[model samples]
Target: MLNYWIGMAAICAFAMAGVLAAGRRGMDIIALLFMGVITAVGGGTLRDLLLGVPVFWMIDFNYVWVASAASLAAFALARHLRDETVWAAILYLDAFGIALFGVQSIDKALAHGFAAPVAIVMATITGIGGGLIRDVLAQRENLLSSREIYATTIITGGMLYTFLLAQGGASHGASLCGVAFTFAFRGLAIHFGWQMPKWLTLRH
Candidate 1:
């Protein structure tokens, strides 16, 4: 299915994020690859399990292979990424993963007879689940602290996607619109250092 390929793309994007972050922290090849695979497939794994469906990577090992290949590429290109003068690149990678995952996850859920509300919840889970795993294992910044509008944008775009699909729009157009909205919102947030005001700040 096209959703499978979309999921694969999201996996690779997240894997790149994990690999880049690991490289910044000076992780060895083995450690980087492991974390990268974990970050790539982590969200989909949890989504499948929670949905009571067969875990995707277990169904076909192609997911693992794809993840590994992406990680290896990132490892090879570490030097170039290391010279980046800004963190925006990593944030954009994360935004890409979230957007693609958000759309595909909701689409999968709808195909499985799940209603829109459930699909929305699953979209959120699939969007942020992998990055949460990566952050915990790699000790990266805690995104759940509301540091920016990351998950918020994913939620908004995902819900809009579901609404459009439910209204009988063309699948490809709707998915693209959803992905673009989420990515643009998140990319801008990263570019402008957008965050909640002091009254809403939870970080010290």
Candidate 2:
């Protein structure tokens, strides 16, 4: 139940971020909404498939409705938000969404009795999967190809959450902290132009 609500919130945040991000490119309302929905559910859908659970949207139509509604709302309000710093807003929202999904994914996996390592990997995927799909569909370079500190932040947050769980911390509070930490790290990276060490980056 907790995971469900967190997932919905993450979907809404990313959907709004998608519209804001694409709107800055002068995309039409329809295009913006399409991108939003993809950004909202791409990650969780993948996570469910991998876990062999019923696709969430299949069992719960509410996820679809919420994602679609958020997308439309973003589209309708895009012009009003046009003057806002779209990129920065999207980055921050993306960071939050990533953190939320990462923690939820790990918690869900552990609930299902998965091994810790697998849970960590699933959490990482849940963090980045939606954004990857959003970028690809929008014809932009995925974050994985950039020098950004995206995946690193996700991994760090997931590890932190897993450690807390192993230490018998309350799952909800630890997850919240993990999400905050990931968002802070990612937001700071964007603000400070932080990048992975050159040796760790691809030489191209």
Candidate 3:
């Protein structure tokens, strides 16, 4: 039950983040809403398809309603927000959404009896797939090329949660720990402008 609610909140966060991140000149409300809905569910949809399971939103229409409502709310509020504020909110909301979704997806994968490595992979997808799609759709610079420690945070945090489970840790405790670590790591990386080492990037 708690995980369900957490999933919903993550959806809302991602929806709002998508709306703000993709906002641009001459974009209509329909386009923004589409971006929001896609960003909110894209990751999980991919994960489900890969896992051979039913898509979550299809199972419960409430997810779509929540995402739509959140997207519209963000759209309405966006005009009042400065670009700086919007970007700041996008950073935090994206971090929070990824953190929660990463651990939650890990739990789901494990429940489906996937191997730990596979679970980790699923978690990574669930964490960043939505944002990646949104960026691609918006034709913006994405995490794939950026130096920010984004996907790394999700992968590392998912690994931590899996490690705790292997060590007999409680699911709730491990989840909280994973989410906290990911959010803090990503948040700090954003604030401090952490970048990948030069060697890690392609040379010009």
Relative to the true structure, candidate 3 reaches a TM of: 0.91
TM-score for each model: 0.83, 0.83, 0.91
User: Cα RMSD to native, each candidate?
Assistant: 2.8, 2.7, 1.8
The lDDT leader among the candidates is 3
lDDT of 2 by residue, 45-159 (tens): 8888999888777888887788888888877776665554764665676677788778878878888999888888888777777778888877788879888788899898888
lDDT tens digits by residue: candidate 1, 1-204: 875676677677778777876555557888889888987888788888888899878999998999899899889877765566533565577788788888878878888989888888888887777768877888778568655677788889988888888799999999999999999998888888888677776557
Off by over 4 Å in 1: 1-7, 23-26, 85-93
lDDT, candidate 3, 1-204, per-residue tens: 976786788788889888988989899999999899888998899999999999988999999999999899989988654477666766787788789888878888989999989998998898778878999999998778888788999999988999999999998899899999999999999888898899988998
> Candidate 2: misplaced stretches above 4 Å?
1-7, 22-30, 85-90
Candidate order (lDDT): 3, 1, 2
> How does residue 125 of candidate 1 score in lDDT?
80
Model 2: per-residue Cα lDDT at residue 131: 75
Consecutive 10-residue window with the lowest summed lDDT within model 1: 81-90
Q: After superposition, how far is residue 203 of candidate 2 from its true place, in Å?
A: 1.4
